[model samples]
Target: MPTRPNYNQSSANHPIINTNNNNNLNQISIMNTNVDITSYVGKVLNINQHQVIVEDVLGQGGFAFVFLVRSSNQQRYALKRMYVNNERDLT
Candidate 1:
C-alpha cells in the first residue's frame, strides 16, 4: 500500500498561508475599540503615519461608514471604516 503525501510539509503550503498571514498582520493592527457615533466626532485617526482629525460623518451604509477627515495641514479626505468582528466578516 502506498502512503499519502503529508500536506503539512508541502512547499505549496507556504505561499497561501504566508499571504493570509501578511493580510492578517495588517488587519489585526487595526483598533479593536468599540466605535460608535459618539466616538467618531472630535476623534483623531492615524493612518499610514498621517494624523486625521475626524470632523463629521459624511455617510454610512450597513457596517461601513465614511467620515470627513482633515489632516494637520488642512487637507480634507473621506475616511471609510468597516466594522468586522470575526473571520466571516473578514472574508
Candidate 2:
C-alpha cells in the first residue's frame, strides 16, 4: 500500500504564511493615542464632549463643517454640518 504525503509538512513551507507577515500583524495590533486638536480650530468650528468640529472652507458646494464624534459604546463617527443661508432653511 502507498502512503499519503504529509500535507501538514507541505503547509509549513508555504510562502504566504511567513515571518514578515507575522511582524506586520504584530505592528497593526499597537494602538495610537497621541493626536493634537488645538491647531485645527477656525479650520475646525466646535468640539463637543463626543465630537470634533472643522470648517469646510473649500466651498465644495455642500456642507460647511465636519465633525468627528465617538459613540457611547466607543464607536467613532464623522458628522458633517451643512451651511444654511437662513436658520429656517435647516430641515
Candidate 3:
C-alpha cells in the first residue's frame, strides 16, 4: 500500500446543515487526502489582500490551477490562479 500524506482534519469537526438558500457555504468539503496538492501543499497563498491556506487541489487546466482553500473564518473557496497573463489582459 502507498503511504498517505498527513493533513489536518480539524475542518471535519463541524456538522453540516443545509439551508433552503442555495449557497456553497452550507456544504461540507471532506478532502480526499489520497490526492495531494503537489506544488502548493503546506503553503499559504496571499492574493489581492486575501489570505487562504491551501488544503486540497481542486483541479488544474492549461492556463490556471484551481485550489481548495480555507479562510481564517473556516470558510472554504475554490481559488483559481490564472497563470497566463497576457500584456493586453494585464493592461
Candidate 4:
C-alpha cells in the first residue's frame, strides 16, 4: 500500500456541542488555515485593505484545506476550498 503524506499537525482546539448522542466527545480543532488563494482560479474573492494572501494546505489529519483571510473592512474570515477530482467539476 502507498503511504500518504502526513498532514495532521496544523490545527487549533475548540469545544464541540453534540446533542445527538448521550456521550459527549471532546475533539481537537486544527488551526492550519493556510490557503493558496492563487489556486482559486476564476473565483471572485472580495479583496480589501485588510485582505491577506495565504497558502492552501491540509492540516495534520485534516479532511480539507482552509484559508485564513482578514478584511480591513470587516473582521477575519475563513475561506474553505473543496478538493475536486477534475477541473471541469469546478463549474
Candidate 5:
C-alpha cells in the first residue's frame, strides 16, 4: 500500500488548518450577516496584501455574489462572495 501524502504543510499558497480542540462557538456565525445586497463599487479590499478595487457587481446567485474588480496594477478579476448560513455546508 502507498503512503498518503502530507498536505498540511505550511505554504504561502495554502491556508493552514489547525485541528485544535478549541471550540469557540462565538466565532462561528453566518458568513453573510447583511440581508441586503449592497453594492461594493468604489470600495477597496486588501487581499493577500494586494489592493483590489470593486468595479461593479457582475451577477448574484442564491448564496453568492460575483463582483468585477480591478487590481492596483490594472488587472481585472472576478471576486465571488458566498454566504454559508448552514454550518454543515462549511465542512
Candidate 6:
C-alpha cells in the first residue's frame, strides 16, 4: 500500500462551504511528502500567485502526476507534478 502525503490544509478545523458563487476565497495547503496522486484531490495549491484547486488525476507516470485543476477564477488548467530522485535528473 502507498502511504499518503501529509499536506497541511488551509482550514482543517473549519468546514468549507461553497456558496455557488465564484467570489469565495480559495483554501490553501502546504505539500511536502511523497507523491500519492489520489491524495491530492480537493487540495488547493498556491502557484505563481495563483490558487489552483486539484480536482482529479488526469494522467500519471513513473515519475510524475498530471492533475486537472481549477483556478480561483474558475479557469481549468493542467498541473503536472514531477519528481527527480537525483541531481543528475536536473540537467
Candidate number achieving the greatest TM-score relative to the actual structure? 6
Better of 3 and 6 by TM-score: 6
Q: Which stretches of candidate 3 lie over 4 Å from their true place?
A: 1-37
- Model 2 regions lying over 4 Å from their true place: 1-63
Per-residue lDDT of candidate 3, residues 21-84 (tens digit)? 2233213222343343465755776554456777765556565555567777878776655442
Per-residue lDDT of model 5, residues 15-61, tens digit only: 22222212422232234557444446677766544567766666667
**Weakest lDDT window of 10 consecutive positions for candidate 2:** 9-18
User: What order do candidates take by lDDT, descending?
Assistant: 6, 1, 5, 3, 4, 2
lDDT of 5 at 86: 53
Cα lDDT tens digits for candidate 2, 22-60: 223322121322323223333422233332333211112
lDDT of each: 0.54, 0.30, 0.50, 0.36, 0.53, 0.57
Q: Which is better, 2 or 5, measured by TM-score?
A: 5
Q: Looking at candidate 4, what is the lDDT of residue 25?
A: 13
Overall local distance difference test of candidate 6: 0.57
- TM-score of structure candidate 2: 0.29
Ranking by TM-score: 6, 5, 1, 3, 4, 2
Q: Could you estimate the TM-score for every candidate?
A: 0.54, 0.29, 0.53, 0.29, 0.54, 0.56
For model 3 the local lDDT of residue 39 reads: 53
Worst 10 residues of 6 by lDDT: 10-19
Clashes of 2: 1
Residue-level lDDT of model 6, residues 1-91, one tens digit each, is 9643433322112222222222322222225545466788888776645677887676677766666777777767766666555446545
The lDDT leader among the candidates is: 6
Better of 2 and 5 by lDDT: 5
